[model samples]
Target: MLAVTILGNNSAVPAFDRHPTSQVVTHDGVNYLVDCGEGTQIQMINYKIRRGKISHIFISHLHGDHYFGLVGLLNSFGLLGHQQELHVYAPSPLQEIIEMQLRVADTRLCYQLHFHTISGEALLVDNEKIEIRCFPTQHRIECYGFTFREKRKPRKLILDSVKQNNVPLHFYDNLKDGEDFITSAGEVIRNEWVTTAAPKGKSYAFCADTRYFEPIIDHIRDTDMIYHETTYLDNLRERAFERFHSTSKQAALIAKKANVKRLLIGHFSSKYDTLEEFEKEARDVFPNTDLALEGVTYRI
Candidate 1:
């Protein structure tokens, strides 16, 4: 599993019972916070997300709605006696901003907080299980989008075949790793005869806080799912362009052009009391589009 849970979906201000921008991307039992907007902690608690499990956080920009809750969340982590080291990736200015806030409060977290500045296209994280890369997005200020790709899993063991081959239980792990089994009779049991190919890993992209950026299509191309911002309805295309924001149709167009498996639109403007029109317009172009409602989990 690869999945994303929407914590806050509104833009600028929280309104119409919606929150600001924040979300959690979960992969292989690890959680990656995409943004920490206002009230993000509250949303996490309400959704039963374990804050302690979050080892990394990615902030797209310095916009208040994008990261206002980060300080509070870190404070709460310290108060909660969290001892795990946490890594945060964002623009360089954010390090100074956070340090200033912590300094003013004379606050020091119990856990070590590492900050990695994102300036352009960069590989933020790479491990045996996952790869995370960031790319710049067109915005009024510095901003970035992220792509999460899961490494392929090991081969799956067929219980009956393994048992038939007289493979010992202790060697099950080796079989899963595609190693041939050596039986007590000194017979070589082929790995493929007892194991099957693993399922293909999934990929997800988060196109955070951008205008109608055409260049972004290359970064998000052929992803299993995409989370794009739709701060306004299609009718307000000009206004959206002027404000360096995106309309639902524009988001859909990007998804369509990128050939993503699915598109999720959110970061709705507080001006719109109803969201049905936003969903309708995006789906008009990309039929697989869905609204990124708060607390909802969309699997990739």
Candidate 2:
């Protein structure tokens, strides 16, 4: 199963009821931490998220609200005696900050730490079952949005067809790979006779932090689920643009244009007391929109 759990959803500041940016994406058994804002570790504990399952972290930008908790989380990992390697993907400047913190504390991690710097749009990470790609977003400080796509498997071969045709077992792999089979008797067997194409897999897009930008539509088109930042309602649209952020309406418009099945919006401004307006504004543009709540899990 592929899902995402919101740890923090507030923008810029942490209020008593809301927090900054943070979420946990779980695909299969692996957990990925996206944007570790302050108090994220506590949020993880509060939500009963298994810290040991997190194998990777993705930071969208250099904003304090996006990655202030990263050092603390890394320190906690060491204190907890985690031995698995952890991979972090972020801008190049983050490496220095993390290294300085580790130096000042004279602490050494028990596991290997791998850092990958994202310098431009479209960074790809391929695993066995999942593929994650990062694209540039129109934020003030070099922000990025990520898309997670499940790899589509090749079609299954029909063993009954192979047997009925007396086809060689070794050629079964070829059929699954969509290749026509040539029998020993010089007869060509069509791939459709033995196999059918697999169904398309699901995809999730995370528009971490951004203003209303048209180029993002192409990157997130046809996603199964999309998480976009809606830091304010339509009334606060001017403030959102001044701060290089997005309003609820803008996020929904992106989802609508991208043809995403569902939209999850959060990163609300601290000034708002209730999220009812945010939901109303977004749903007006895209009916399939939902307000992202902390500790709530969303299936992609």
Candidate 3:
């Protein structure tokens, strides 16, 4: 299963009981953190997320709201005796920034931490279960967005059919791999006759802070779901453009253009005390749009 749990949904500052920016994308029991903003660890604890399962972290930018809580979390992992190696992917200057913080504090992590500097479009992780890639986004400073695509599962065996064919248990793995079985007499037992196709894999995209840019439509096209930032209401279109941020309507338009199954709108500006208007505006354009509320898990 593929899902995203929102840990923080606010932007720039924490206000009205909302946090900055952070989320956990979980697949097959593994957790991948996206953007560790201030109060992220607290939010994780509040939501009961398993911190030890997180092996990778993807940071979009160096904005304080996006990464202020990273060092603290890393420190806590050491104190807790986390043994698994941790991997962090982000743009440059972040590695330098984080190293400085650790150095000044004279901190040493118990687990190995690997830093992968993101530049342009790059494949960050490709394993048996999932494939993760990063793409550049238009922002005030260098930033990137990530796409997580789960790998297709193996076909399922038809137990009764296999038994009727007298197929041995030793060949069950091959049957699941879609391979045909043959008898000593050369009688072929077609794979499809005893197995069913697996379900299609799911995909999700995380569009970091950006303006109303259409180029991203190509990267996120036809995704199962996407989390796009809507830092302002549609009424503040001009101001949003001036500040390199997107309005609610703009995010909806992108989701509509990309033909995504669902659109999650968050990264809300602190100026708005209420969020109903943002949801209303985005849904006006894309009916499937939903607010990315904290502590909520949206399954893909």
* Deviation in Å, model 1, residue 222 alpha carbon: 1.5
Off by over 4 Å in 3: none
What is the full ranking by TM-score, best candidate first?
3, 2, 1
Q: Which has the better lDDT: candidate 1, or candidate 3?
A: 3
Off by over 4 Å in 1: 158-194
Provide the RMSD of all predictions against the true structure, rounded to 1 decimal: 2.7, 1.5, 1.4
Q: Which stretches of candidate 2 lie over 4 Å from their true place?
A: none
Candidate 2: tens digits of C-alpha lDDT, residues 1-300:
789999999999898589889999998899999999999999999999999999999999999999999999999999999889999999889999999999999999988999999866765679768899899898988999898888887889787987888878877878878999887789998889888888887889899899999898998999999999998888888988988899999999999999999999999988888889889989999999999999999997
lDDT of each: 0.94, 0.91, 0.95
Error of 2 at 101 (Å): 0.4
State TM-scores per candidate.
0.90, 0.95, 0.96
Clashes by residue pair, model 2: none
Q: Which 10-residue window of candidate 2 scores lowest in summed lDDT?
A: 119-128
State the lDDT at 286 in candidate 2. 98
Error of 2 at 14 (Å): 1.5
